[model samples]
Target: MIFGTCGQRAPSVGESAPAERRKYIEEHFRCISDCDMCGICAVYHNQDPLLVYRDYIEGTRTFEEITEEYRR
Candidate 1:
């Protein structure tokens, strides 16, 4: 799924995703040194970006569903 300000495709979550998926999620979605170019910090505000996307990364929920929670 495509998420965050970078517009990169997120790694697909599968029924048996390996632990590396977590690293991929963190590296891609979490805040890096270049915060000005990434909008995730603003979207998550004081929340941890990893926590915000936990369900999706765990394959327990869709990215859309998690994002919809914030939209509401």
Candidate 2:
């Protein structure tokens, strides 16, 4: 099984994520500059950094989407 950013297997493309997991990720992750704890492109969408990275790698999501939705 392929584990996703959230430490669990990822769902197929276009599949909706679980609400609870999504909520947890939202509460815990934040995209910001001037920080380098994990060293991954996670400065948009206010989504889980790991998830963002995973999505990016999988080609399911794009940097543009993150910028358009979360970047201020």
Candidate 3:
């Protein structure tokens, strides 16, 4: 249950693999319907967008660093 560059399906590749490797992958960027983005995600929703904008212009942030801050 993994993907690689160009949305390629993982775990089925080698020099001897079949040429039709693309068929093994059904979709790209699957969504999790059960995810409601509550709790911690809610906190991010409240504050992180502004931080993200600041990061873009102010050159003082990164998504991973801010996300790790929220996790802590």
Candidate 4:
């Protein structure tokens, strides 16, 4: 898949989207540096913490599912 950012050329086909996104996050995303290992970011961000950090994955969960309890 081709990964892209605004004003940037799309990654060549056959590149890994997860790997590309992971690299971008590591270099530019600041909260990752001081993350307390708390699970809140997962719920708040609607992503799975383990998949995101350990496996460099994204879009594993949704806002409705993460905040389901609070909406009860």
Query: Of the candidates shown, which would achieve the greatest lDDT relative to the real structure?
Result: 1
Instruction: Tell me which residue pairs clash in candidate 4.
Output: none
What's the lDDT for candidate 2? 0.46
Better of 1 and 2 by lDDT: 1
Model 1, span 2-70: residue lDDT tens: 464458555566643735556666776766658787667677765786788788777887666777778
Question: Which is the winner by lDDT between candidate 3 and candidate 4?
Answer: 4
Off by more than 4 A, model 4: 1-16, 30-56, 59-72
Model 3, runs deviating above 4 Å: 1-41
TM-score for each model? 0.61, 0.28, 0.30, 0.25
lDDT values for all models: 0.67, 0.46, 0.36, 0.40
Please give, for residues 13-38, the per-residue lDDT of candidate 4 as tens digits: 23446566455544433344345763
Model 1 residue runs over 4 Å out of place are 15-18, 33-37
lDDT per residue, candidate 3, 1-72, as tens digits? 433224553333332133223222212212234447434235455543443334422334433344456555
What lDDT score goes with residue 14 in model 4? Answer: 39
Count of clashing pairs, candidate 1: 0
Descending-lDDT candidate ranking: 1, 2, 4, 3
Worst 10 residues of 3 by lDDT: 22-31
Candidate 2 Cα misplacement greater than 4 A, ranges: 1-47
